[model samples]
Target: MDEVEVVVAHSERATLRVGDVFLKVDTDQARIDVEVEVMTLAPVPTPEVLWRKPPVLALAAVPGTTLGSLGGPSTGSPAAWAAAGATIRKLHDAPLPPLRGRSGRSIAALTAELDDECELLVTNGLLPADLVTRNRQIAETALRPWTPAFTHGDLQIAHVFVEGDEVTGIIDWSEAGQGDALSDLATFTLGHEEHLDDVLAGYGTDVDLDVIHAWWSLRSLLAIRWLNEHGFDPFAPGCEVDVLRSRM
Candidate 1:
């Protein structure tokens, strides 16, 4: 019998892997619906959905290792990162998923969310005041409107799977929808800033470096609180906090 490996376990959800099958257990059935819909609509590779029963979503595991993990060195080659970028480009160019939940958030809402999160960071002393302030200021650049694209909301390195130089699959589509393209880029390169250029290269388009940098600041700031609350330290060495400090 194959051992059930706990892939990820948290307050909101948990995923277990048994051999080639992954069992995703979550409270939000709506999110599972979105994942199924997005995987069907997306023009890129995704895990094959074997079945779903409310809280349990069974998916066949993609045949490759994760591109990388947060705060860890990426074993994926530059070419693999580039391939992942190309895959993202393909998704962005595809028709938007036809779902109300896939609609991008309004700028006002995003601004308010950012403001609230920033206050929490400062109040908790989770990060230095100056660092928080500067990054918050820099993050303002990303608050503007963007032409929505089919975006993989959480395109972290870990969610990207690759076989050799080819991207085999992208997982975790609960956040997929029409949104700012750079948000996906920023999330993909979050703690792995050094790979940004390689990704952009394969994305095969020019991008605003300033906005991308701003998103780096914005994303890291917003995520620290959630990470901490989830029992992960954002301030650990070479982690999200280090990524923020690198800006200064």
Candidate 2:
């Protein structure tokens, strides 16, 4: 067996090599800080493979252990939720560069992506028909008249680090883009409903709760379907399924 110097490891991602420098950004007044690491993996022939490449060395200086860790504080706790909310606000407040690839500015494009994902999952027998219908309806409802903001598409406790009542940093930028702020907020709420009020309060604005709830529900359903189709059990540690299920 070979060994690699592991800096951080979770079901979905890992980081190694401490001295590797990557892109870092912080917006304190807005309350966000990010560090981006270039991946060391060699590029595969396929573009799809390229999209799936891991960071060569990824690291984010978040405060506490991930909220979803077995022995860590539950994300449902008010303080924990507040911390998560603050972290998200910071991310949202950060200055964003133009989206590199496809412009995610269109609601139609976003809806199409969601629909296609659902269809693929359904075709593979990974999602129940009723759930698919519900998910589609919710996705459509939530996406209509969407408002764009710098968003971390994957906003979950696992990607967030907290210390006491403060969020130190956020990790993972693979799913980031300029998109609906509410969608990002929804992702957080769905994954951390236990801290709903505190999170919203930290957000410092009145948000449409229904839209956020719908988006989160749809996001969870999609995640479940993807896990099922991929033969990945959500209950296992370090698995995307586990992260999603933990939110529930």
Clashing pairs in 1: none
Best TM-score among the predictions, by candidate number = 1
Candidate 1: Cα lDDT at 238: 69
Report the C-alpha lDDT of model 1 over 101-143, residue by residue, as the tens digit.
3226888988899899999999998887899998999999999
**How high is each candidate's TM-score?**
0.96, 0.66
On the 0 to 100 scale, the lDDT of residue 26 in model 2 is 26
lDDT of 2: 0.53
Candidate 2, residues 14-118: lDDT per residue as tens digits? 445333322222222111112131011111010111121223422423345566732234544577667667666765665653542122447677677777777
Model 1 per-residue lDDT at 188: 88
CA deviation > 4 Å runs, candidate 2: 1-55, 58-61, 69-77, 100-105, 229-231, 235-248
Q: Name the 10 consecutive residues with the lowest summed lDDT in model 1.
A: 96-105
Model 2, position 211: C-alpha lDDT score:
78
